[model samples]
Target: MAHPLDYLYFSAVMYTSLGIGDIVPTGHMRFIAGVEALNGLLLIAWSASFLFAMMNRLWDWEPCVEPKDEE
Candidate 1:
């Protein structure tokens, strides 16, 4: 039996389209790997969007506390 991390690594390779031939899925498992690949791709794209939005918001905003004037 394979560990869960094995599935994750396999999925990652498939998502990157870099199959190394050590872990091959057969039967229904093949469909599962396909789904994982699709999920990885979508998640990566969504992350990119989220990161950009966050950066834009941060860049436009200012610090909460302003510096006090010197005596």
Candidate 2:
């Protein structure tokens, strides 16, 4: 709290959902950590869905047709 680097360190840990246990959050700060973890999860899920949709759209599979033999 005294130095700017402390805030950066806390934010990096919270956003990544690492919860390294080196620094503990108290009171309302705990709520913020929970929210950050949830947001990170949602963001990851959204990214996976977006990538799946993009890949599906870009890749297409067609059934192969065989020619009939002459009698």
Candidate 3:
């Protein structure tokens, strides 16, 4: 409250959905905190899926085999 760093710390906590007991938000801030937590969760899920899709597209998972010699 007294220093700018406090707001930064609060934002970090809210964005991560930590919801620690200390430094609780009041009034309008509570709404912002809830929105931030939800946004963080959605972004995390989206990022994971996007990364997985990208990796799948880039990697080949099939196995390779040598041909048999003719008799």
Candidate 4:
């Protein structure tokens, strides 16, 4: 049937954090979109967190090194 297609279509919309206002769902289906939106937000946050951690691990990123005064 078209159920999976519809789910995926809406999910794709959700993935991009886009609500085109075309596929409006009724009743319980409405909750699905909300969940998708939340998922998208969490995923975006998670990606940002992961990238920050990766960068910290990869770079020396040192600041305020002690100055060496040669006598």
Candidate 5:
């Protein structure tokens, strides 16, 4: 890219898989873009798994018991 801002914008689009179509990568850059997209996806999946596990650990799952009525 002729300008630094162009590369930054292109990298952002690739990592997020936005596919905005405003800028296109060529040759080796295409492979780099694919890798960036994959990395982003993996990071997101890993984060979700971690959050789910944390929530499960923190939640109280015991069922409530009703008191017996005495005559």
Candidate 6:
């Protein structure tokens, strides 16, 4: 059995696609790790794009804090 903390660390490494190689997933776990890495990559990309859109809407290339008033 694997320790909880070790499992967590492994999951995080998979999620981040770091591939540190310290711990290797075997059998079915390998598929899960691959999926997790893809999911993480997509979510990160989505979040970044969403944030960029929000920033575009909120500021017109200015460092202002107030959100733009929508008509």
Best by TM-score: 6
How much lDDT does candidate 3 score?
A: 0.85
Candidate-wise lDDT, in order: 0.83, 0.84, 0.85, 0.84, 0.83, 0.89
Candidate with the larger TM-score of 2 and 3:
3
lDDT of 3 by residue, 1-71 (tens): 25888888888888888888578888997898999989988888899999999999999866568666699
Q: After superposition on all CA atoms, what RMSD does each candidate show versus the true structure? A: 5.9, 5.3, 4.3, 4.3, 4.4, 6.4
Candidate 5 structure quality by residue, lDDT tens digits, 1-71? 26999888888887777769788888898888899988878887889999999998999766579766698
| lDDT, residue 11, model 4 | 81
Give the better candidate number (1 or 6) by TM-score.
6
C-alpha TM-scores of all predictions = 0.63, 0.67, 0.75, 0.66, 0.67, 0.79
lDDT of 1 by residue, 1-71 (tens): 99999988887798865677799999998887788778778888889999999999888776679976699
Which ranges in model 4 have alpha carbons more than 4 Å from their true place? Answer: 1-6, 61-71
Return the lDDT, model 6, position 67.
80
Q: For model 5, name the residue pairs that clash.
A: none
Worst 10 residues of 5 by lDDT: 60-69
Ranked by TM-score from best down, the candidates are 6, 3, 5, 2, 4, 1
* Candidate with best lDDT: 6
- Segments in model 3 whose C-alpha atoms lie over 4 Å from true places: 62-71
Each candidate's number of clashing pairs is: 0, 0, 0, 0, 0, 0
Over 4 Å off, model 6: 63-71
Count backbone clashes in candidate 6.
0
lDDT of 4 by residue, 1-71 (tens): 46788878978887677988777878997787789888998999999999999999999975678876799
lDDT of model number 4: 0.84
In model 2, the Cα lDDT at residue 30 comes to: 94
Candidate closer to the true structure by TM-score (higher is better), 5 or 6: 6
